[model samples]
Target chain A: DVKVTQSLRYLVKRTGEKVFLECVQDMDHENMFWYRQDPGLGLRLIYFSYDVKMKEKGDIPEGYSVSREKKERFSLILESASTNQTSMYLCASRSGGSYGYTFGSGTRLTVV
Target chain B: SQQGEEDPQALSIQEGENATMNCSYKTSINNLQWYRQNSGRGLVHLILIRSNEREKHSGRLRVTLDTSKKSSSLLITASRAADTASYFCATWANSGYALNFGKGTSLLVTP
Candidate 1:
């Protein structure tokens, strides 16, 4: 079975603080993604990495960035956290050209 | 910019009854996938149907795809209380590695 693990299940940060969410996958998948899920918006992509050091912006990438220094780890960074950034953040990974995906338990971020 | 939209945002059914949900996408897709998320948990991949295929099934779940209408349907037979969850439809676009997800349909199966 494939396992995707997130660094934190819940986090709280003050406004203007910096936050980091880490994700690791045991399957060595080539694609990693970060998404913020809201009540009515569904899972909107924030950023994705196809390979080490390669990143692309998704539909809602503002105030967020990603790092993929290694094949098994992907990190999402919030340069300056704001209250509006509070959300359920999910990390997902999939093998190259595969239809199935494995997702982390998700981090519920609270930016106060 | 959303790729898919699920119909009947929420549904409630008793145990042993069948639950059906529909999803419609806006653009051409390489494949469509269904995922289930329990309350406060990560999503679990349920099934996938390619654009060329019309229907697919696994165990008690059935999925149908209509490329011409750009829509798909998922049916869960003999649903139980444990089947309560939010079901989402995700689409893999022809060009990207990421899957675009719909808002999801929340299913409540009561005993």
Candidate 2:
């Protein structure tokens, strides 16, 4: 089975702090995505990368950015975390030919 | 933007009963997928149905898609206590590499 590992399970940060959430996939998948899941808003994509050194903004990308320096690793960065940014962060990866996504355990971040 | 909207925010059913969830989307899609997420966990892919296909089944789960109405339904027969989880419907558009997901329907199966 493909394994996606998130670096953190829970995090608490002060407002205006810079935070990083890391995700690494064991399988050599070409696509990686970062999404923030809120209570009633479902999952909103923050960023996605199809290849190393490539990235694209998703629906709600204003407060987030991503880095994909390697094919196996994708990172979501919050330049200046705010109280409203508190949410469950999920990372998902899909192979080039497959439509199904394998997700990491997820990180719940709270900005105070 | 959220392309899929699943109805009945919550559902409760007895064990051995069947559970059905409905989803509606706004635009043309390449495929529709159903996912299950246990509390405090990430989503696990359940099934996928292409736009050209009308229905598909895996195990005790049956999925039907109506492209004309841009709607889909997922039926899980013979529910068990372990089947309790939140189910979400996601859509893959013709042009994008990412999927749009719905809020999800929380299903509870009581033993």
Prediction-by-prediction clash tally: 0, 0
Residues A1-112, model 1: lDDT tens digits: 7799996999999999999999999998999999899998899999989998999998899999899999999999999999999999999999996878899999999999
User: How close to the true structure is residue B17 of candidate 2, measured as C-alpha lDDT?
Assistant: 100
What is the Cα-based lDDT of residue A103 in candidate 1?
Answer: 96
lDDT of 2 by residue, A1-112 (tens): 7799997999999999999999999999999999999999999999999999999999889989899999999999999999999999999999999999999999999999
Q: What value does the lDDT take at residue A6 in candidate 2?
A: 97
Candidate 2 residue A45 Cα shift, in angstroms, is: 0.5
Cα-based lDDT at residue B96, candidate 2: 76
**DockQ, candidate 2, vs. native dimer:** 0.92
Tens-place lDDT per residue, model 1, B1-111, is 479999889999999999999999988887899999999888999999998899999999999999999999999999999999999999975447888899999999999
TM-score of each: 0.98, 0.98
Q: Candidate 1 overall Cα lDDT vs. reference?
A: 0.93
Docking class of 2: high
Instruction: Evaluate all candidate structures by whole-model CA lDDT and list the values in order.
Output: 0.93, 0.95
Candidate 2, residue A23: Cα displacement in angstroms equals 0.3
lDDT tens per residue, model 2, B1-111: 899999889999999999999999999888899999999999999999999999999999999999999999999999999999999999974447999999999999999
